[model samples]
Target: MTAFDAAAEFDRQVRTLLDRGHPEAAGLTAAEFGALLAPLRETVTERGGAAVAVAPEEGRVPFVLVVTREVVPVERAVALTTLAGRTKPGVVDRHFADGDLIRFTPTKEVELPDAHAYVLFDVERGEEFCGAVPEDAMAAIADRGRTPLTIEEGIALVTQYPAALAKNKCFSLGGSRCGDRRVPAIWISQNAPKLGWCWAGNPHSWLGMASAAGRAAAGT
Candidate 1:
């Protein structure tokens, strides 16, 4: 199929899956996911699409998916911080890992499963995406007893989610310091920021305001 044909088929297939998953999806089945996304499969035959993750035993992710401007509906856990970037380019495997959170709000016609909900990010904030109870983002994770993602992995996961995040000017949400210095440095938007790519990684970290709030709430 042509690129347009492939894209259209992919969209149709995913929508069918979502529709089936929803009560309204009357005639959808998972068996056709491959047929729906058949065009992308050409990457393997022509463009050399393959696994390139950094390490076999690195983070929780086993592989990565790179869809440009395609908002795929993953479990809300997949979304980390607000507008986290995508995975690093040409790693052993990269999805949207730019050391940022993957932000989401409400966008239509993006990815499978449908709906937006702040998927992931490269930054560290309080309990924003994790909700009242911090749960793992990937729904495929059957093992709930696994150790919480390390800061590096957490950042990696959030960064994998595609969106836009800014990192130019520091967003100071005044609070404690990084250590025992009690420094007034918490990276949150000075103004009410919606869930989107607030900044791009320059100093390699987004100072999320939620971190301070979470710290204060924890009495740390």
Candidate 2:
């Protein structure tokens, strides 16, 4: 779509948020709101996604949303939040790995099914998207007594029993820490073991493997 068309769509989304009683939008004048959407509009046009404005609660500043077709990495999400001038931008999805966002908020305020259980803000999209895990799946994982696998365990599992990774839907969350920096992690889904090759023998090791695993799960 043309930049102009994208901007119009963004404006429409913002208006919808306002109509939904977003307090942050209530505070901003139309021009100010437009200014906030400017960067996001350009981003969506260049990147081919949608943008929205999330109203802040309890006196927080409103954020510009930058929606993408795939799950955004934590580092990239942080960068997007920084670019948008928010200390903590929201990064929402159906499933999240540890470190996908620095913090997570569980809210029933979102529109997606089972999203009321938990949601992450997309710093780039500036709003929540329809990717949060459904409530049934969360319950199933719990019922199966499945806990997040440690980095070592994940590596061992993939290395020793590669096929089992996909069959058992075994995946790891965020446990790999790289020095002082925390790499943004992604959820490991049914196809995790196949992702090992992406980080196999890499210096970052676990973190790379987890990142690749998340991408594969998200099909990004």
Candidate 3:
């Protein structure tokens, strides 16, 4: 949990995306995707701190490479994510099988860079809000001057640190909304990852609202 090689970590993330066929989904080759991300290396190196993914209360900040839905559809990205040697692809809940039907865009408060991809820093698991309603947790997050994690950001966290999506500690993506009460969330299922949604007004003892200090688009 000490400071890590920022550049190296960024490289590893790029490889993860490539390995998971992100570029292919986006109609680009691995090399092309690499080229697309090359400009962000310097920003990552300059902004990255201790290589940790848990909330800052744990004493270390975290950063992740985020490819927006524009680059690779959320459903595709989820299916590409894996748990170590597992061959099972992540699943999207039946409710959202038609990904196109859900326009789960980032909330107004979550200002992502204009680019297709970016980096999120100071990530938090939001365990402190476990058992709190998503709507309430969001207000608390805003009160503290923090931004909630969007679906893309949440996926990026687990895509980089699978262990972060643990049992009884999964988080809600309050930063993304579909004009209804459903709040997206990522959690472990059958040893693989799953993208699902829960009611915004409801509270779960195991689900907390994940958050970030801020984000920066790649190449900016």
Candidate 4:
């Protein structure tokens, strides 16, 4: 899609949130806000991606749009050790340090009950985990071979395993110089680093791995 199309879609998503009684999206009606998002739309389109809007369930924070990069197959297990310096220590680190091979299997193409979630496989342990999934559903999802994940599915995966993904180096931390304090920044491009919600200065904010990966994928 073109940048303008992305921006229009983003605007529609934001409007939907507002219609759903999300107070945080009130500010989005401003013209200045639209201007600010113009470049973001362009970035997302350039990277062959789309934008997904995430709203906090608490209705406290503003609705944010995350950009999704192009979908690419990760056929082989990516060694966690390779991400040492690029990523901070986390679940992936601990597992890799223990000599475990990490595999992220996409379940987007499968017609499963919970197609929205991605399956994270610990190859050594033969264990699989998905975020916000009930214990009963895990078995069913696992039975379905991990399918290819779309950019949106990848975002959902990040949302499900924020700490684990960040620690494993799936996402990097991004920061901007906010006066004397260097505060964590949001992702705008695929080449840029990703940050968890914990780094956004407002821990309560819901901008997590999903947003970060989405931003990076969009090459903002």
Would you list the rank order by lDDT, best first?
Answer: 3, 2, 4, 1
> How do the residues 1-220 of candidate 1 rate in per-residue lDDT, one tens digit apiece?
2222322332443443343242122222445433433444343223211121112222122222222122232222222233432222211113223432223211121122212111111123322222221222211121322122222222223334222123432222112112221112112243212222222111223332222101000011
lDDT of 4: 0.27
Error of 4 at 193 (Å): 28
State the displacement of the C-alpha of residue 210, model 3, in Å, after optimal TM-score superposition.
0.8
- Model 2 TM-score, 2 decimals: 0.24
Residues 84-141 of candidate 4: C-alpha lDDT, one tens digit per residue: 1243211222222222111122233333222211221111101122122222222333
Candidate 1, superposed: residue stretches over 4 Å from native: 1-28, 45-63, 67-220
lDDT of each: 0.25, 0.28, 0.80, 0.27
The Cα RMSD of model 1 versus the native structure comes to 18.8
lDDT, candidate 2, 34-106, per-residue tens: 4543444444444332212433222111222322212223233222221112233223333335553344221
RMSD of each: 18.8, 18.4, 2.9, 17.2
Give the Å shift of residue 100 in candidate 3. Answer: 5.4
User: Which window of 10 residues has the lowest lDDT sum in candidate 2?
Assistant: 211-220
